[model samples]
Target: MRMKKTTTAAIGAAALLSGLLTLAGAPAAHAADGCNNDNGRTVRTAFGGKGQGFELRVNGSGNSTCAWGRIVGGAPGMHVWVDRSSDGGRTWEPQLGWAEISSGGSIWTEAWRDSNGRLMRACGDSGYNTAITCTTWY
Candidate 1:
């Protein structure tokens, strides 16, 4: 039940891009009708760390039209980021975060794994929409 994801991976201002880091995101299209989505369900997530897991960043509006995206389509503050816990998903990095709060929000993100291996990722404002959302897989 993986949802189609859309995203933008712009790191720093274009003036600082070094062509090293990847700032790519998911596609733009959204589900035709998340109608099947349960009621009162917010925060949509998928995962693969150790135990069964997935976390919802936001609540389900039950519209199926709502997803991890800019509140108004292509906003400039919200974004997505991800980190890993090679040490058995115990400790993560000090940084390696994502969001759009700095710029007032950028866009929400669809979570998923990059390969066939088990993966888990996510994207969303911490809560107040002050930082960019993020997603990562491994």
Candidate 2:
């Protein structure tokens, strides 16, 4: 009976490990710039428009070495982008370029390297004449 229980426990552990490995092998979301959004976390969020239906997210890499923008509830022709600043969000240094949501209601923009005390933020336009919204600097 003891041997039987040990065999069962070993089988269960092997199954669990196999499942974990499968998940770990899953592909990550990659942008044209080759940055992986799967390694990032949303550092800030902002809402806009009626009932706050539109959403903007500022995602930062796990190591704080990269940042990007993502828009949810977006529409075709809508736009999203990431901004970077070297002076603590006082003024924009350069933008990472905009991503037009050509289809669906969600999209991710190109990533920008966040280095040298740079701050990053997410911004978007609904393309419906509504005012643009931006998340706070991270």
Candidate 3:
């Protein structure tokens, strides 16, 4: 009876550990859950190379005054981001918001507030050594 109880305890411990690891590996929810298209719009789009078959988008909401990046029709491992600038595209910080397609055709980055005269644009790469492409600032 003692041996049976020990085995049962071991199995329970293993199951608990497996559940904890799965939760740790899962992606976290976006911080701007409500800042999506339902509350915003696609401000601009950046098309990649004709053969690359990828488009990067800058999405924003006038009411929320926030922006994010989205990549559509890209293979897994491709990358997308939103860039922000105060002076224009000529000089700006890179990858203000970003996301990678882990196993899907599309993905979007976390939203960022576009206040204080900030300008935003979308950019992406084929993730196979292709050059990065970006859209006009908006």
| Distance from true location, Cα of 64 in model 3, Å | 4.3
Weakest 10 consecutive residues, lDDT, candidate 3? 50-59
For candidate 3, write residues 44-105 as lDDT tens digits: 77777633333333344364567777777777888887777778657776775567889977
List lDDT for all candidates, in order: 0.34, 0.69, 0.70
How do these models rank on lDDT, best leading? Answer: 3, 2, 1
User: Any runs in candidate 3 off by more than 4 Å, and if so which?
Assistant: 1-38, 50-64
Candidate 1's C-alpha lDDT?
0.34
- Where does model 2 exceed 4 Å of error? 1-34, 50-64
lDDT, residue 115, model 3: 56
Alpha-carbon deviation at 7 in model 3, angstroms: 37
lDDT of 1 by residue, 8-70 (tens): 323344435643334334322233333222332334444322221223332233222222222
lDDT (Cα, tens digit) per residue for candidate 2, span 1-138: 999999999999999999999999763433334444666667788875632332323344444476778877767777777777789888884436577878888888666667668777887777757688888888
